[model samples]
Target: MVNWSLKAIDYEVYNGVTVGDLILVFAILFIAFLIAKIIAMSLRRSLADKMKKGEIEALVKFVYAVVMLTAIVTVTPILGLNLTGLLVAGGIAGIAIGFASQKVVSNLLSGLFLIAERPVKIGDQIIVGNVAGFVEDMKIMSTIIRTYDGLYVRIPNETLFTSNITNPAANSARRFDYTINVRYMDDAEKAIRIIKNVIEEHPFALKIPPPRVFVDSLGESGMSIVVNIWAPSSEWTDVKMDLLWKIKIELERNGIQIPTKRNLA
Candidate 1:
């Protein structure tokens, strides 16, 4: 109650901001913001030009945000604001945000590890759990996949890190095994020769390893012959589907009949 109005006027004169100082502070802030923007743009362009798509894009965006925030923090003190209070508030807010976004942070870190390790890459065919698809895109939080049946799938990075990955196409070569059953009365040796010939004639089959046909089992229905062949991984599907048709046509041409089961007593 001691002359509050008089004290207010006196304080204004003693420690008040001048118009010129205000303009200077504003100009500095503006210049700093412009500089930060330019740096961010330059960094973004450089990273985009050099890095792969998806996660790199997310990282660049995050960097830009950090740069802008740093510029604002640097300019705040110049505006006569309480920096200690601002920092304390920022710390409290960050703690809250961190707690709320723990899962998101985990995903981001997992994605970073994925990018660094390169266990999988774009265009690679991978199977995770029940999901099998080609990797279409990857980001900090998730990866996109396009299934063989034209379905789109989004899998979280955290899940990827925890799950098992089966990359069938990782290697250049893969093996295919076919089981053929022939009547016990049929000549097993003759059937084996015909099966080997069929595999050798297939254009997609790799000739280096050579095709192998062996009698694996003699079941109640027929004699089971196992045919194993090596082919390039890229041509696995085509070779698998077409081999049976080619084998059937060749067996028919050679008068090698597959025996059918009759009713038993």
Candidate 2:
């Protein structure tokens, strides 16, 4: 029984490829995978602050693939495969497959371009096509987005490349407008002055572009006052929410009220 087991362990599988060769192939592959994982972990730690999460992941995946492919090619000889002939055959097959999968090629090229161009980065809130969300990851073939409502969306690179992308975070500053209505009986000039003071009090509101407050239109219920305020894009949402209520409160304190239809009647 021991002799038979020893013979089975040392037997040649095919083409002079023994059981030892198979074991060596697996060992090399395991080593390659371990090395790849170690390198990826090291890179993530080194580039955490220097690069975005999506970029780091993309780079790590690329490195891992290259390492595994190299190991595979190197171990092919253990299985009695020829590298030179395989490369030549692979080149011809790649060309034929490339022609057949034009869209796949296009997506791959688009992904490369996006990584290089960096029109939109990971964590950027963007609206591409009909989807509006924060970019979760930028992959080689597609992009992942986490929507405002917390749904994950995958967009193909080809579609992203061809579509219009609106990245509000790209700008240092952004403008938001509010159409505030005041009672027609209230002094329009006084309301304007009060609104300006409120904007000036807010730290996020930009003073360079200046705040614009003026009577836009006279409606049946009240006078429509246009309020255009500029704030840093990063804080625009908070500024919009915080300053708007303040404006209303300040106006009310100054004896300027938002007239209702009942009051007009």
Candidate 3:
């Protein structure tokens, strides 16, 4: 009558792994997993506004791996299993695998540095190592890019880290230049005024750093007039195309010759 049922529940299984021990082990492991998840979620919440999606994902994965490894090591001995041989075997295997995939490891490390350094971000228009595209996704080993023509490219992180990266979207404004050729007889000063007027008429071009048009060089066929304008980077392409069209139309309306040898000389 002295809690016989409880006594029966305390039966041993094998090699110090009793019924109670099994229950305790499960509880410990369950708590460990839950704690790991909680910590991962907390880190996500805390860094949500600070880091990119890729960085957060990597950090969460790293945290979970460390937590689970610690829990496995702590509970292994309690389960009455000898890990002496297993540890030795695992160490040797790990070393072998590490050496075999050294380049993969290098890419992984480079990806981490890419995240930390943040030379480019998702959706940024960039040119890296002869590839030009908007970043689609940043992964641990490689980066995905969507080219202007819609081709998808995957660049290894090692290449991305080592190569030169050009981010045109990083700055607020960009410059576009056009070398306009005209007959030597065409009034250079008048042509300059016409180009400046067209630039001013267009709203996208920056005004504070006024556009300039001048004779850059003198050639046998014509005068090499140079036009330089700065516009907001976001509208760079549109403005560039529009300005070229406008300049050509004005030059033609004023009967300015582009001085082709066939037409002028």
Give the number of the best model, judged by TM-score.
3
Q: Rank candidates, lDDT, best first.
A: 2, 3, 1
Q: State the lDDT of candidate 1 residue by residue for 105-216, as single tens digits.
A: 7887788788767788888889999999899987778888889898989999999988999988898888888888777767889988888888887898988787788999
TM-score of 1: 0.69
Which pairs clash in the backbone of model 3?
Answer: none
Quote each prediction's TM-score: 0.69, 0.64, 0.72
The alpha-carbon RMSD values of the candidates against the true structure, listed in the order shown, are 8.1, 9.9, 6.0
Query: Local distance difference test, per candidate?
Result: 0.77, 0.88, 0.86
lDDT of 1: 0.77
In candidate 2, which residue ranges exceed 4 Å CA deviation?
Answer: 1-100
- The predicted structure with the larger TM-score, 2 or 3, is 3
lDDT of 2 by residue, 7-38 (tens): 87689999999887898999999999999999
What's the TM for model 2? 0.64
Question: Relative to the unseen true structure, what is the C-alpha lDDT of residue 196 in candidate 1, on a scale of 0 to 100?
Answer: 86
**lDDT tens digits, residue span 198-233, model 3:** 999999999968888899999988899999999998
